[model samples]
Each structure stands twice: as structure tokens, then as C-alpha cells.
Target: MSIQLYGLCETHSSEECNFYCRVCMFALCKECKKQHDIFEHEIIRAYKVNEVASFRLADLESLRDASDICPYKGNGRLVEVIYKRGDGIACCHGQGNVVECESCQYRLKSPSAKYCSIQCKVEAVMKMNESESVTNEAKRKVETISEESASDVKSFTKRPRE
Candidate 1:
């Protein structure tokens, strides 16, 4: 009905341990524990991050996929940290002026490359021309209908009692 001693120090062989080192998982006696505490207490607890150097594409890929902190070591030298932002440079693109394709979201390689492929560009132009033709035809029909209605109204105004 009494508590038992599960931890015993190896140094003393028969001494009951009072402290446990979780990092190394070692049981220590009072004297050894006090020594470790004295040295550990002298060490600093907080650390700071200096500016990071240039980071490679591979490094950023891992950071994005894993959602982990920068893996750079030694003053953060492996790569520069770039926080993703809406108004900042895009994720897949470099620092250059580019436009999006009218039909799809693909970024145009150049100003001349309006769409992602030739098919898209051609299709867009054809759609524009077809819409223009339809609009013109509709306008002509409206004008003709208005002219005929005006003539009918004039004839009614000139008619005698009938």
C-alpha cells in the first residue's frame, strides 16, 4: 500500500533519483541534478533571426507544401524568405510584366501572345467578329421596323371618316 521508487541513479547504484533529464531521459541524483541546473540556468533561453540570404526554388517548394518554417541554417543563409501576398509577385512567375489570357487564367508569355495557344487566340477573334456582325444586323432590323411603323401612322392620320 506504499509508493515505490521506479527511478534509480546509475552513478550511485542504490540512490533514489530526484530529477529526470527528458532530452536524454536519464535519471540523476541530487548532486548531479544540481550541477546540470547550474549550467543550464546560465544559458540563454530566447533567440533571434537575422536577415535570410537568397533562397532557391526547391527550398520554397518544400516550405509551401509542408507549411513549415524556413529550413535555412547558419544565420538563415540557405534561402531568402518570401511571404506569399495578393499584391506581391506571383508564386509561379518571375519579376516581369505579363498578361492573363482572355479565355483562360494562363499567363501570357509576352504581349504578342494574347492567349495561351493559337487556338484560344483565334477563337477569341472569331467570337468578337461574330458578335459585331450580329449587333449590326440587329440595328438594321430595328431601323427598318421603325420606318414602316412611321409610314403606317402617317397614313392613319391622313385617312377620312371611314
Candidate 2:
């Protein structure tokens, strides 16, 4: 594409912008391009941005590296955006941090997963069953004792019948 002046550069008011910085999302002139180059910024011709099929100004700014502070206390860890779909929602987590399984306390396969594996889920179910059975057994014993006590009390009270 032929080099054309897009507009007056925002940084340098006197010079016209011929290039754009993909990282900073700013239009820059030849003089300003030199400063952007120091940081290895992606500088492209201003007109060519529209020609690129995948170039979207909004997407470029939203996909920047994460710099937000982490929520977990005492570690001062910083969370990073792991993935983002077209829906604009982001799945973020601290670097090297992992979610644990609700049942086994082992590292989970994924953030949304409840148990680490099928075995952990099965074990948790089995434990719940065992506890329920024990509780039922105790209730049965209490009922049996209560019935026996009632029968004995009736016999003793009805004594001396003529």
C-alpha cells in the first residue's frame, strides 16, 4: 500500500501519522515510531490495519497480558488471564496455583471439575452410604430397646389381678 498520512500524530502534533502500533493501539508518525521501536512494539502501516482480516482494535486491547493483583491473601500472587472466548468472559488464575478436588483434596483436572478423578467421586459416594447405614442401624437399636421397656412396664403394673 502507498504510504499516506492517516492524520496528525497524537504524540507529535506537528507530524502526520503514517504507522500504527499494534501493542499500544496508537497512531504514530515516523519520528514517534523510533521511540516505539525501543520497546520492540509492532509497528505497521496505518492503512494496512484495515486490510488485515484478523485485525480488530477492540480485541487487541482486551487480549493484553494480565497485570491485575491476585485475590488470595498472604501470597501476593498476581492472576493472569488463561483463556478468553469470543463471548468476552475470561478464565483467570494465579500462576502455578491449582484447584483441589472437593472430595479427595488432590489437584483437580480442571478449574470447573469437582473431583480429581472418577475414583475420588466413587469413594466419596461410598463413604456417604456407609455413614447412612450406620445411622440407620443405631436408630433400629434404639427402637427395639424402647419397645422392650414398654412391654416390661405394662406387665409389672398389671400384676396382682384376681
Each model's total of backbone clashes: 3, 0
User: Local distance difference test, per candidate?
Assistant: 0.45, 0.49
Candidate 1: where are CA atoms >4 Å away?
1-96, 156-162
Q: How accurate locally is residue 2 in candidate 1, as Cα lDDT from 0 to 100?
A: 16
Please give, for residues 40-140, the per-residue lDDT of candidate 2 as tens digits. 57665532222321222332335432112111111232122111111322233453657665554554435654443333444556788999999999999
RMSD of each: 25.9, 22.2
Model 1, span 1-162: residue lDDT tens: 011123465666676664444334344566656667744332111112243212332434533321222233435333322221122233445646766555444554446534443234435667998999999999999999999999999998989877
Model 2, C-alpha of 95: deviation from truth (Å): 10
Q: Residue 117 of model 1: what lDDT?
A: 32
